[model samples]
Target: MLRDEKQYIESLRDGRVVYYRGDKVKDVTTHRALRAAVNHASLVYKWQADDDKRGLTVYKDPENGDVSSFFKIPRSSDDLIERFNLIYQTTRFGRGTFNIIKAIGSDAIFALMLVTRRIDSATGSKYAERVTRFYKNVIKNDPAIAVAQTDVKGDRLLRPSEQPDPDMYVRIVERRKDGIVVRGAKAHTTQGPVSNEIIVLPTRAMTEKDADYAVAFAVQANAPGLKMISKPERAAEAAMNDEWFVTGKENVETESITIFDDVFVPWDRVFLAGEWQFAGSLAVMFPTYHRFTAISYRAGIADMFIGLGKLLAEYNGVDDKSHIRRDVVELIKYKEMLRSTAISSAMMADLDTETGIVIPNKVLTNVGKLIANESYMDVVKHLVDIAGGLAATLPASSDFNNPEEKVYLEKYLIGKKGTNAVERARIISTVKEIISSFGALYTAAMLHAEGSIEASVLELYRSYDYKDSKKLAMYASGISEKL
Candidate 1:
């Protein structure tokens, strides 16, 4: 029922209780450390309001007489591709905050998958009707929805049912005629406190004994008994605020752990309940959608890093240096490789699910994710190398006004013709923040998020067609007998 940027902001400001350390946070909406991220989310709404971005943010759905997010009911390959492009545009603006965009895309994709699955078959549930209407209302008003996927997971060594603490993963505590009361906690929830609604799901496949943990639903971010505890920011604004103007702004959003103390979810919002078999389907489907979005979104992030590296090369008067030029060229190679892999995944995509919505071949998409994971980090390292020592050694902006230090800074930090030493130093400092600082965290996240390096390698091993390749080798070599 939420609509508009102002309304979305107001929803987060009112009645939502968030914790940091131990005490309840009264106002995270404007807190400096958190404001950048909070504001970045708000801009998503503002984009819908704008004449330029509105085209990308909202779509007309024939199922309902309303506008909705592109992900709410992406029925065709074109619909899916547009969603990828839209996310990429937003992500390019905040390559520093593309992680938040990734989180948003992940939940949106899951929601669409659910809606599509429900609507396509006569035997399917009417959950899609409820979601379609919800999404329509959101688009007409432009509300923000966050997603919670991972569970707190008490013991990594044990399954959800085998864990010593039964409540570690969120599960149904009680089912009522009107609703169900959920008791447990969700972790790594991005934009948890500030969103209008949250789509919650089981982190992994569940066994028969884990049915209670297999439930999936959408609940208001501030639903009764729901409490969000925000994680600390990477570094305070003092380190990057001034530099943001000279460089790019940091997309500062927070992720958090959300505790549900017997929180009730009404029947209307509960999509999958007590359907343990569907839990694994949801788990596999959601990450494939997430990886699709990541393939393009992270490619855009690497593109930005490529730009910054070129800028730093020029600023350091090494634009003409052969080795520096080679470094810049290598960075481009990595960046382009990420783009090609992502685009190929899109081009080769086919409809694999019962739902009509086309999904990127998981094998190809995972390859894209793998290439992005490795190349993006190398891009960061190469950029740092080209940026040189000043990125790490530059003094704070506070030193700019000190009369004693100003003379020395002015004499030695100067670069080339037509640019003052002070200006070059400022530019170099900003570049340092991008390749180092929180920017480095974003680059690392590109590779590790969704799944880790080991996970991707394992998937590659599982997905390859080894038996077919073996058969082909035996036939071609005339060794018809089985090995």
Candidate 2:
């Protein structure tokens, strides 16, 4: 695929209806709230054209024999491994900045490819053909895309059909001769404002009565009647890690409450329509692939935490301490755990053999994500612990740059005997920015990005191979003669 970074930026000037901070943003590419994410996305596109990652980022699509980014349907274990490598390599460029968030849209399409085929088998619908066409269009166009999988359900305990406010969940209100009209809202949609396209999917299982809600479609991000709202980054967030941090102005991840006010979707673009039974299929399948992406990209996150933690330890002159060394070791173990699980998930991937779609090993994908969610807080805790109070009480970057304040601040803040004040302050400043700027946002994202922690646990319980465990236990206790 051609990586048209400049074109991608210029295309954002289109009148995408985006509301942020009580006002409509004129242009997301230049808007303070979304510019960072735009640039972050640009890097991914740029990497596709750059010469640095020759075989890693660029690959020939085995199916079509065209060279493109590895974000495509994996036809085999090799393809899955390639996807993992590309994601890991790209992610390490930023601390999960242009991470799973951008690429999962394609994964959604791959999920849809398999699910629609299943639907075709069950109901004889030609939705799978439409999805295949859409996939081709996506690969050819090379557009930046975002996926909205979560709906703004009014009542947390109720299903979409049970909601008093039917519009709380995205649903088709009118099935026109030309297409369908949908109205509802999706909250916490990442990269909502600036993407070239938005792929919408049903959030959960649906019954026959919920057919209207069981719809999947793609629309132009600047489509009429579609609105996106994003919150502003804190001043502290942008001030630190200007280039690498997603919370920074030049590289941020955006989440918004996206509203579909009677947005019309043409029939050709509709991947799922009134297919209630298969709603859960898309819901399950999409996340399975997405979490695999999450697990792979998290390797980069672990690397960041490890590097920073070790640096903070060395800067603090506590590198020799037993506890500090132990913490660093813990960070390394966690990093390898994430990376190894991701690799295994790819290596042990499953195939919808006939469809040529490679699905991730559900157990490993979910387990990896679950472990990452569980341990993320502790990993950050170790980082914070090693950094000491300096991470908190550090002076602002502006103060350090000030001619008058530089000498006094730097002289007092020199961390170790050998390290200069500037070097010590610089290290602490970096730690300070990353932890403080994007701390809460990154924390919340790590907790619930792919899905909630409880949801991951449930998926693991439901998909895990428990038969072997049960048989082993039964034989050991003499509960059964043979497993």
Candidate 3:
């Protein structure tokens, strides 16, 4: 049941409660503030429906007909590598922005599928069956999903149950015969307002006392008591229309602070309830797949940066300069380093024997993500250097349009011989957009999104085989022989 863009757009008119700029959005699909993001999200469906892109975006399932490749669980390294290519190509299609509408949702589903199976095997619970049913429905309906995991913690030092305000973390406030009621808010929920569903997961490990917080479930985006307060789009309304890179809404992303004001989740939709022990496992498993997605998409974005830098050099008539060539090489190194790590992570995939799901190498995935997180600003720096002061000083497009100002801008803004002012301005505008306020939001996301830099560092340290490294060091130093 592959959905097209029209169906995906029509699904969002479901009376979801969404607020933006202090006003209740009448319809997210049409609201000025959110429509661009909605359109951006619709590309996931558009790609699936396009004849040329169909093969890359979806696969024909013998049992289910056409299913999104995102929903296909990776069974081997080849499957994982294919998934990487799908993400990379799609990110490039979006003009360097990764669509989270499906990528993130599928990440959560995969983690849920793997973790539930383990829990059910150990406890004889029916969680695995429930998750399977939910997953089947997801593939059948092809709904866009938004994952809400990061709680708006009130105090950093305190645990969930120890918080002065108990509702700081999403928790099961009441258990009913048919379902559970959840109350809390998750911050930085990407594309929540436009998504068809929201999947919730525990943010951290829990204890017996924190059992209530160890809850995971899915609810419709327009479910009763659910609310999404979206952050304003980073690009100004004027800029969206004026900037070459920002025009057409091709490269936009949105985030929301999703609120679950006692939202109800049916038992079938509840994957984890009061299972404090397994909460950490699910929390960790999600990032394992998501960071791999992150690095893959970042590689695509790095490719864009590399191209932008070369264009800047060519336009500046410095393409032959040794320093310019060196900078371009550095950008290539950054791009391929991330791309190669993603490939290695997939090639060194780990198989969950019980579930037959291929998991990306945890250490390599984290290492790649950490590199992306730490080095993104440097990528920006290199491009900014190549683009020159014109990247920042270029006049607004409106000024360029004015008859009085057009002549001066045209005569003064010309680049290398044979290149017109407009072309040079467009390239500089793109570089400016990448380092502008909009690009700042993207920069902050690189540091914080998909878990923080420290989170990846911790995961890499934890997943690495320290004992083996210690043994090798001991043998090299003759300590092993002494023993």
Task: Write one digit per residue (lDDT tens) for candidate 2, span 1-483.
Answer: 455689879988998998878998888887765777787787777777777865566667766554456556688888888888888888887554544445878888889899988999999888888888887877777778899989988988988888998998999999999899999999888887878889999999999989999999999998899999886666324654343222375557778899999999999889889989999989999999989888888887788778888877886789999999988988898889988888899889998976988898999999899988999888887877888888888776667778999989877887667777766766666677667777778788889988989999999888988889999899999998897
What lDDT tens digits, residue by residue, belong to model 1 across residues 1-483? Answer: 224567666767767778876778787777656665667777766766788877776665665444545445555666666766776777775543453532463455454556446433534666666555655555555556677878889998888889888999889989989978998998877777677778886778889998888877888877889999887665436455454333234466677889999899998777666766667767667777777777777767667767777877776788998888888887788767756766666666666466566666677778878877776666767877887888878887657767899999888777766558777776667667665555645654665777666666776787776888899899889888665
Best by TM-score: 3
In order of listing, the candidates' clash counts read 4, 5, 0
Which one wins by TM-score: 2 or 3? 3
Clash list (residue pairs), candidate 3? none
Every model's TM-score: 0.88, 0.95, 0.97
Q: What is the C-alpha lDDT of each candidate?
A: 0.70, 0.82, 0.89
- Tens digits of per-residue lDDT, candidate 3, 381-407, equal 788888889888888777788899999
What C-alpha lDDT, on a 0 to 100 scale, does residue 346 get in candidate 2? 86
Global lDDT for candidate 2? 0.82
Rank by lDDT (best first): 3, 2, 1
Model 2 bad stretches (over 4 Å): 62-67, 235-237, 240-247
Backbone clash tally (model 3): 0
Evaluate residue 310 in candidate 1 and report its C-alpha lDDT on the 0 to 100 scale. 83
Question: Lowest lDDT 10-mer window, candidate 2?
Answer: 238-247
